[model samples]
Target: MSTDTDRPLWLSGHMAPVPDEIDAVGLEVTGTLPDELTGRYFRNGPNPLPGNDSGHWFTGHGMIHGVRLNGGRAEWYRNRWVRTKKLADNSPFLRDDLTFDRAAVHANTHVIPHAGKILALVEVGFPYEMTPELETVGPCDFGGRLTTGMTAHPKQDPVTGELLFFGYGFMGPYLTYHRLSADGELVESRDIDVPGPTMMHDFAITENHVVWMDLPVVFDLELVNGSMPFRWDDGYGARLGVMPRHGDGPVRWFDIDPCYVFHVGNAHEDEQGRVVLDGARYSPAAFTAIWSETGGPVSEVPAADAKDPATAAASTGSARLHRWTLDPATGKATEEALDDRGVEFPTHDDTRTGHRHRYLYTEADGGAIVKYDLRTGSSTALELGADMAPGEAVFVPAEGARAEDEGWLMTIVSDRAGKGSELLVVNAADLSRTASVRLPRRVPAGFHGSWIPDA
Candidate 1:
């Protein structure tokens, strides 16, 4: 636990399995996002220092970043480079068994201890380094062959409590700011506002709009917008906006429906600021959209994956999850109440700030944590099933926890058969059973996780 100079600049993310080791296997994760942006876009972090027995993690991709070393029980996993993403066409390729090795997925950046410090915000790309000549003019317009890229998001900075990241490296459009001191072993720093490189994902920053949920023909956002030449088609329709991070004036749009892979949790406003989109997911619910300022509401939640055609043709994909009640100002809609109750939806959810709504699901067989009592429509299950796999759960209510503690959930318990991935915990109301470790294998489903209560 000594990377020397004292340790505790952690940022952790995971997804494991199939390790004869090195070149990646089945679902991967490694870290680095002080703009060394690594790959595989989902799950990886580090700065976890205490016992530091090589828990080393930090991740980012599409503008590279690294650092992966999760050795425990048996051992055999390591990779280093304090930092790299100096964009020389941002390279990191060599696929042996090949399992997504670049794109630096996300999740884990919502901590802000305060005074003594503990900020570790994340979202990446843009460590831009030599690789210009397809028509230079790069620094982070999202161009430079993407070499010097950034465009990442995951916010939280209500002021000095630090830990607010928004990326686009190679020195453009940054907003990074980390602070963690109090002798846990780490100093401090800054970065703010930002201008160039823009593709900010699923955002929500209000004191004056940064509100994001974008998609306007991404061939990687029009190949970094040099002259707006087009050809990209990572198509997902897209539109749900708000601007003025420093202004270009009126860049507001909300045509709704086209949110390919969306998730906007914990947005607040009421007492007149208006907005309230307690939860979201555009597909899997045929329809979804909501906003506020005296408007926005769309409802529909009463799932159906199929009645019985042998798991409905293997669940064709309705997956299942419904509980609608969009009140976008009198558009008035309601799905009554679990209609007939019988679910298998919500791949992720963890919210709090009122009307009581706590959902985190995954099923065909297991993983759950549901508690929604939005005024007695009632819905409570608080935990369930074999080595639960509550997809994306995290609800940290009450500051510093423990009141019989109604806050705890950090998941991943799927086994691709030995060393696939297994990191579980559940007790956020009824979902009993705390700590359940089983990562001697299987982890290629690392979508998100966080629970560093002053560590």
Candidate 2:
């Protein structure tokens, strides 16, 4: 058996587990903080219980680490595990009848505050609502209207204040779309057609349409026991569906190349009425390698052995910034490479959702945060050094912001050099460090997060 020191790279160092809940007060800041950036920055990711093997990174229990900022000072920091029914009962996801429990969700993927509720979301179960204080409220069904599972990546329309999201299932009625009004009412739910069930992690939205991804990563019945039961099948094919937002219009599905997209930066309608979507694209080989390593036990390989060409190819799979333009009129789709650098966890001003926006901030595969200029097709990055690995860079708009990039980018940086984690504040315009609030412990690098401003 592999010892703790011999564990996988992801289960070691800064990615290791922190067993207890923590409350930190009055964190020290390194530079001048933004006055208007008063709110809570909550990030959710898999922080599995110590001594228990989660088997896969995606299967770990969700833990949220939040930092509260007020009056240009770091007020407090707290880390809490989302206490769910599964955690409370110590039950398995599958019952004796071999059926899956919809409520036995990890709730580890993403967290966002919407309609006066902070929801901790996974794609497979009902959203668990949490308080602004980071306490778990319980699984929410949008007042019992949302019967099926909810998507972690929901698009909030700035123009309508409406939330647009979808759920994909292993069973029939494979895809469904939902819309919630500004005041948190579940107003619409419709079944969406797809070729089959795909791992649709994220989608895009334009002013008049919702974009759907029918990609190759699919659920396999035989591998249901694995942490991530889905595998990439080249023959499943890939396509993009564009559906009208407010009508029963037929969804226009345009078959695209064989690839997978995990997250989208933004989507908008151009002058020619073509829907434009940008995100991180993963090729077939990259998808295969990433999923392959995720299974089996967590065992760390030596640095020299990890650098082998074959080993590098297997483990170095990274998503590059890619763009797709779908012309609804012509039924034709074209793709372009925005930047050659590997990036993921893309974010922009939430108010610019379903609209044309210029700047995109993403975490680079390396230890850096990249800022992409869509209009100019230029790129700038802030390197956090080779020792520290940062999580997603969330864009928080400034008060009365005048420009698109006029805001602050916040991210949690994990120090590999023995120092604890810290929340970084960067100037969104020039990709420069503005301030950093030091934390008392290491915060593991996890998936998605949100910046919820004080109401």
- Cα-based TM-score, every candidate: 0.29, 0.94
Using lDDT, give the best candidate's number.
Answer: 2
lDDT of 1 by residue, 1-455 (tens): 63323432221122221222232332232221111111111223322222322222232211111112222111122221112322233343323564222332221222222233322223443321111111112222222233322233344434333322344332333333332233322233234443333333445544444454544323233333231222212234444444444434544545443323334444433454434343334232222211111011222321331223353234222223333333335533333223233333232222232222334333333445555443355556654454444445544443444432355444555532223454444555565655544344434333343333322
Q: lDDT (CA) for every model shown? A: 0.33, 0.85
lDDT of 2 by residue, 1-455 (tens): 76647886558777777888989898999998988888899999988887876878788889999999998899999999889877778667678996666677889989998889999999988888999999998988877798678899999999888998988888778999999898889999999878787889999999999999899888888777666778777578889989999888989999887778989999999999999999998766555556655553222432332445564465456788899999978999999989878788999999999999898999987699999999899889899887988889999888888999998999999977435899999999888889999998889879999999899
Q: Candidate 1: lDDT of 259? A: 26
Clashing pairs in 2: none
Candidate 1 lands at a TM-score of 0.29
Clash totals in order: 60, 0
Q: Which whole-number lDDT from 0 to 100 does residue 60 have in model 1?
A: 27
